[model samples]
Target: MKPTRCPWRGWLMLCLVWASGSASAALPIEHWTQPNGARVYLVRSDSLPMLDVQIDVDGGSRRDPPAQAGLAAATALLLTQGVQASPAGPALDENAVVEAWADLGAQFGASAGSDRLSIQLRTLTQPDVLDAAVALASRQLAAPAWADPVWARERARLTAAWREAQTRPDTWAGRRFADAVYRSHPYGQEARPETWAAIDTAALRDFYRRHARPCDARITLVGALDRASATRVVDRLLAGWANHGCTALPAVPEVAPLTRPERVQLPFAAAQAQVLVGQPGIARDDPDFLAILVGNHILGGGGFTSRLMQELREKRGLTYGVFSQFSPGRHAGAFSVSVQTRPDQADQAVELIHSELRRFVEQGPTEQELAEAQAALVNGFALRLDSNRKLLDNVAALAWHGLPLDYLDRWTAQVGAIDRDRIVRAWQRVLHPDRLVTVVVGATP
Candidate 1:
């Protein structure tokens, strides 16, 4: 007897397999401009019993007043710590906020990076739990506590941390590297000890109003709800957020080619010298971003397979590990190669780096290397969106950078299409050997 022909079920099975395979690319996103001036990005997923929401303000160290390098960061730190005393509801201080989230099995935190400040929350999808979490979170965001006591404590704590960071070689190296590469650009400004000392409650209030305005905020919600429900919950919570007239991100000045290499050394008693080198890199929205990203992987970003790693670690044994990065900002940010090595080997390492950098720029990656890199990046793309938090982060990044909504969908294709010649041309345009700044701390004189 012949088996029954069930083509309909076979088709359904095929679709299911395809959907599972295209999980990362087919991420359904509902993005829109909110009525209250915030840009919101939402993705509904009932896969798990929780929801993740992140709010990004287009204000970070980049928006700080030139004189107050730490103000923008300080402002973000204070937003989640405020509370209002209402006879109707519970006390909403920072401690109360923490306890309420804990009681609901939710997590809440804030982070300030170079270009933005983000507040993240993860809570159970249960109606009561989500509702309470949203209400508590909104109180702090819509109407901040701005308590004098909270300001004093947070300021003292931050100031102490800043002062203590000076003692750390890595921290100091980072600050120095930024200063060397960015120069007059706002991205280069270091948080002065005096700036932290000067920061007061008044400064914090003004900075928050100017930088963290409602219009500059982008909200991203992912996981555990339908679009309509997510919209209602988010809109209801943030509807009252009004944008006061205050400019956030200012025009970033153009970065000029360095007339000569800049080498600034800070004497520190350590076993290894920390070195940083490179010049101005591409902007966040640069058209050649994919080309550069793929090329970078073959040069130094690909751990053991990287040219720099193979030469510096495996062949010469100069140091344990050396890494490269491109920190793209509103304007061109730093493209840096950094390593730490014995004081005696610092000079040798720097020459090897320069040699590899020059050769990479001239020859680019081989076909085999490019193919391997493309495979590595393309294969690993799914991991970038494996979880709610990771997906939320990518969505927020797209919203913040004004990238195409389908950027992630096209990422693998873009990487795979980049040939050796295209990457080489991209490097030729970006990497300038003559102008690269070389900075080494604790190198032998």
Candidate 2:
């Protein structure tokens, strides 16, 4: 029997099926252990023909040996410079592997944060491309060549970069803010010229061996791939890599509340002062985190609707933008309000921010404000899953923080349940406006 299809009706049916399918599709999360005792999270999505592989080692700058402060950062950066398989012969340079990866439309980049060192690769999902990426990453991870010439060049480059950072107002403000908040903890130390100078090839090798191990690492896979195929890719590429079985470093010391105001002045002719103000806040697992987040949004975390933005930008035209964020590290992290305003208005801007913060602490946000904040947060929560990359980020963060598998499913509900009283109490518990550390770069007062 010949079936006649109506073109318009068929298209409508197809659209309905696709919409229903997408609606029913769960965020696919598959976890498995590798032979080397490493944990891997696989997120399978065929939305795009790309793959993102992220390897997170437990040691970052916080694990830097006492003397070699920047060792972790330097080692993470140099991981892909060259490997034993692609060592620099007489003619080839150590950067040969790095250049090769670039030429192949693959990028190998690493970042050092408070808790972990992350190495990420983004590449197409073709079998050959994926194979090359995996091989390249495996070689870089397992057997970094750390050629002397390349080390020397990179060290010089980093030293110069560090020197340059010292002169930048934003850099100065961030470094000062971190130092002020963490205060004598390894988390406080900024990479300096002396620290970069201390990093030698031997030191880098020791740092890498101690920290970058399969046992001490976790892998996150995202983008267009299936679980079965992604598992095979990770296993074949990373399974044979040996684990060094290194112990985790001692936890960062709890940051005591800032006793007094601390300030740093960076000399610059810029029109606006870069102001950073805050102290250490809650960890990721804190039950009151959502309430505090909502409170902060009303206070300064929300862009235009926040109190700080209203007081500084909307009402008084003091600054272009003012915002606050609470960055939750493995340990306690910073809760900061940042603003940039003309130097003459710096003191006024700081005072207005403080006034709003105090109001939040004392009076708390109104029920209407809280409701709006929660609604916005809950409504926007799904946007985090709009892309595979973002979903992978959430997966990585969840795995890193030991969050439950159903964390995302419950996130919006939890946020939506936060009430005005809860937000007020959370604000009072976590924020001490009076004890905040303020860094003003390019301002005298």
TM-score of every model versus the real structure: 0.90, 0.87
lDDT of 1 by residue, 101-181 (tens): 656666677777878878887776777777877877776666667778887787688778888987867787787777777
Prediction 1 global C-alpha lDDT: 0.78
Model 2, 90-161: lDDT tens digits are 222455775556545666777788779888877667667667767776666667777888878888898888
lDDT, model 1, position 62: 75
TM-score, prediction 2:
0.87
| Pairs in steric clash, model 1 | 45-224
Candidate 1, RMSD to the unseen true structure? 8.6
List clashing residue pairs in candidate 2: none
For lDDT, the strongest prediction is 1
